[model samples]
Target chain A: MIFSYELLAQAIVTGILIGGIFALISVGLSMIWGVMRIINFAHGEFLMIGMYIAYFLTAKAGWDPYLTIFITTPMLFLVGALIFQSTIRPILKDPSMNQIMLTLGLSLILQNLALVVFKADVLTSSTAYTRMNFMLGPVVVRGSQLIAFVGSALTAVFLYWFLQKTESGRAIRATAQNREAAALVGVNVRTTYLLAFGIGSATLGVAASLMIPFYYTSPTVGLFFGLIAYVVVVLGGLGNFIGALVAGLIIGLTESVGAAMLPGSLSRVLTYSLFVVVLLFRPQGIFGGKQQ
Target chain B: MLTVKDLKVQYGAFVALHGVSLSVTEGQVVSIVGANGAGKTTLINTISGLLRPTAGEISFEGRELARLESHTIASLGIVQVPEGRKLFPDMTVYENLLMGSYSKRAKQYRKESLEMVFHLFPRLEQRTKQLARTLSGGEQQMLAVGRAVMSKPRLMMFDEPSLGLAPLLVQSIFQTIRQLKEAGMTIMLVEQNVRQSLQISDYAYVLETGQIVLEGSGQAVLENEHTRKAYLGI
Candidate 1:
């Protein structure tokens, strides 16, 4: 119950790093929701799937977490595209509730499938960077958190460029705004949706790979991060990328500081409490008005 | 350079467009006028590739559009400004125009297209950074037209551009339509505003209950007793 500057600084710094990771993870959800107009309840399953893929690649082939990016990113992209084409895409014109149900079913299917493949047992990874740390004033920067922070920032930059500069990126944005208008303007909305899903899934893949060195993984791993990510998506605004970025970091800091201040149970309660408050006050989120 | 022949459309058991046909020669300003639910939008939707025809053929620049995709149709220089000014509400005025050329125009030309759009609608240029939803109704209509013009289409379709405009704004929009026609752009205008649409149209087609009730030169159609009494309210 005593106040300490070192503890406070440490808490804030840790929150920022974790927030970066959360931002990177939630951005895809935001982008998908913005363009496709679906909440994608199964997003957490995709994250879990990425983690397992990283685990198998590292365990079997002795690949580094970074190396797993090349493999898992593309593979997850394809997986995401397939999920859209097979299930999500078919019911795209249906009501929003139907789309939500489809993705929820997808989540269940993916979680169970991972349970069958990787089992309910927990798994983790080791890297030279995993245990490293940096000392700044009274605060410490753990290696895993640093990597997650830097990696998440880099991924966010990449996604921003992809959405703004590239033609395909613009097409995806157009599809998000007005699918019919996009079609009328010569945008292959179908392809754009497929590409957006792929890109979104690929982001999760990167997130999963980065997480292996730091966090334990199981079939339910996605549920933990996925819940945080959903909170981040709404906090940042449903489909706004920059909103997600700011919201992610803010939530990260809040959660970190909360943990330092209260017991773990109370910290979660605080986080959710903040979520409800933010929802009530500004349901659109901080950067809600901005488009992806 | 556009021809729609016997285009048929159905909504469940009800037929909206039963073998309706229209044609637009190169650089001609053709208008289609009908009352509410008279299939004007259905016809435009079919032509723009938003809706598929149950039967009939649509050909633009000699390419068969019956089975082609909507984007493909647009890339071939057939663009449509839909019934509502479907501007991306969250995007800036400039961003909406940029999205107009999103599929066809490249980055290098984006600047020029933006300039062209700005020149066409000075109001949009004045509020370039403003979100589209914040624009006035007339400005939004202008933004919609400006957005479509960014594509530089071979054939452009307008669906009720004056749907919610004031009288003065409607006159300005008609003047702009005339200017576009003078610029040698082939346009297919769909409107319920009969008098103004007929005034500027090179040719006019009157649709009644999804059928072509009258068709002729603009002057002739304006003079037609059925068209004048029912539509022009003369």
Candidate 2:
């Protein structure tokens, strides 16, 4: 295979745009994992739910996909809180194996529920700009891809600021580092756990709403993004927010360029191979995450 | 400023603390010294709301603290520097200190608090940008204390501040504790280093088998036959 500057630039641009969406998806998963000490197997299903909600809202009420954030963000936030309270909270004191199994069960239930309701059919938002693109020099960026990338970047920044600056935000950071210590410092850690989980799920919802305009959604749509998200989170470092952001972008570019250079299947294999390498060498990630 | 009456903590069928009672007056440095598994950590942990007592009453500043969350207890100004420097290893030295002051009041006076902490342990200021995990053992202990100090607690509890340090570093840490005492901070020092703990403590309690076996003025406890034999190695 031969390489040209034009092809390289286009692949890189595509990678970056895709990376933004991956960032949006992975950060929530990482945050929840960091603070709650739980791996939410249902994470991808929540994204699927968000995409479906956006699809139906647009199909029925004629609402814009971006505008659906107003409804979906808060809705998902509430749903996340409820899930934490009902499902996650009860098993929190249990062993890690129990927590993982429970969340995995919840994910299966959610995905099948979507399958039952939406009938496993692929759906997408019929936005006018879905196919629109603008050329920059010899490269071009699809409007929807740009939106997914920019939206995720902005949301990641907002979350970073919230975690660092706000009192509740500080509590989340504290809980992530030391739950008992955070509690000792007057951080309502249980409440913070619920909030972190909620925020994590909402981030997925945000990603889903953004994604529907750019990509198609099925009951199993989460499976596709889920694999990528798992890669992104592991590559970025477990529970490191900023690391996830950087890793998302890096994975995005790698996937796009790799696909362009090699067979598409080989590119995915190469992408997954990066995860294995990172885990083997730098398990802590590019940015040092939690020490243990 | 604080009182623990009839405190009993149990982990399922196993009781870690049994009817423990103690008190700390305002601006006093109280020490609780005991052997491993003697419930020193359990007592502090219960008081800090990390563990719920099966039966007990803990009151701080005239308010009941039994049902309050640990963070709520912290907000009431009862902060504990937990055993093992539980610093966020990935964070910088400065960030670890900032986490101590996560409370609203601490945030409001962060600059003043940071200055005071730096003054006490100037080494932290020099390595403010370095990752906390990279710090030496003594430096990590300083960072732990420095982090707790940022909270501006009305009563700060140190849980084995001298656990893992060199002899020289241990001496300096004890000296720092004395300085904090002179600076008028209400402190509860829990340690296995009995001799040093007794020396710095204004009042001391000896815990054995989840109960207080002895309580006295610091010197009196130091002079006790048991203290002399078991801890001071006299």
Candidate 3:
């Protein structure tokens, strides 16, 4: 393959588009971890569930994956709320290790459950837009990827606006800052926790819907994506909303460009090396420490 | 407007309060003066629903508040400016004040409350964009009180409002309390500064080792032999 400026530009564009979807996946994890102060190891399982839902809606019922977002997001929100209430809430005040173990256990159970029900089959949903592409000067953008990029950017903007301008959003930020003080000021901290967790899971649903058009869905589909989200979250600074989006783009560009320049395994090695470098020098993240 | 009767609080076999009782009437500045480890903070915390009393009744405007959550108790117009000035450190001064009016009842009057807070603490108004952690000690204390006032509480409680401040700032804080009392805002104050607290309070209670040893008008308590010797150092 001859090295060309057009090829490099195309690769960068594809990386950015994919990075937007990664932002959509990671934002929810950041929100839950930020507010509740729990790692929520099962976050990837929620994404996996979302992917399966999108697949079923599009593959079995002949519904468009884009339209399936409306159904999956709310369903995942409920799932997030239920998981928090049933598993996470009881151990909220217990030792940090207990919360970690519980969420880790949840991740195992969910992955195994999917294996039993879905039978480890790789499934994907295809629409007319999935194969369509548009050219912008020297760069080419896939139709579905463009939609995902636009949707992810809009979601990030909406979330930022909510946190900055809305009353409930401010309450959530207050709780994250000081729970006892928030309660003193009449903010129901428990409800804020539920809202954060629910919203976080709903974002996963949106990501899964966007992803199903181009990616394969299986029991362990969320494993790699979830791991990447953790990297993005850390790279952006844990719990920083805008940081997650920007870090996602950086990681996406790094992966795409690395693959073009190096072997496939070496590309992943390059990404993890970047993670180590980020952890060493800027442990707070590229943006800063924990800010909503 | 507020009454706590036979309140007892304990932490794992250690008693913090031993059946203490106190009352604050409408528009009165009631002060609870005590030395360190005298259960003053515990009493305030219990009333604010942060700590639960093993035995007692707490009523505000004749409604029982013994079993309500902290946020619920706060929503009922009993706001506390806690010890150490627990403002949200990461948030800006304006955002911290905005969070003070988190309850639905206070939300509608938020603009007016902000104006009132700005008038009371002009420095806070100037520092609205500054983070709470970046403010000076005195400014942070002012922000704490200003944040409390933004809730439009029928009864405002201060837990050591002047704990860590310069002498001049302490006088100013006490002056603000007096002005609040003059404005018909019922206030309950807990302080280690016996002389200043008694000077402004309509009524005062002396707490020692988790028990109320003396209760009287501020003047009478200020003149007592025990208070004069121990707390007043005169």
In the range B155-191, model 1's lDDT, one tens digit per residue, is 8899998898889998998888888888789989999
Highest TM-score among the candidates is held by which one?
3
Residue B47 of model 3 has an lDDT of: 93
Q: lDDT (0-100) at residue A111 of candidate 1?
A: 88
Better of 1 and 3 by lDDT: 3
* Candidate 1 lDDT for residue B112: 75
Regions of candidate 3 where Cα sits further than 4 Å from its true position: A1-6
Q: List model 3 lDDT by residue over B1-234, tens digit each.
A: 899999999998999999999999999999999999999999999999999999999999899988999999999889999999889998999999999998989888999999989988999989999999999999999999999999989999999988988999999999999889988999999999999999998999999988999999999999999999998788
What tens-digit string does per-residue lDDT give for candidate 2 at B44-144? 88888889999989998789998988888888788888899788776678778878888877788789989999999988999999988899999999998
Clash-forming residue pairs, model 2: A183-B71, A186-B71, A187-B71
TM-score of each: 0.94, 0.91, 0.97
Instruction: Name the weakest run of 10 consecutive residues (lDDT summed) in model 2 chain B.
Output: B85-94
lDDT of all the models against the reference? 0.86, 0.86, 0.91
Q: State the iRMSD of every prediction, in order shown.
A: 1.8, 2.5, 1.1
Q: Rank the candidates by TM-score, best first.
A: 3, 1, 2
Docking class of 1: medium
- Of candidate 3 chain A, the 10-residue stretch with the lowest lDDT total is A256-265
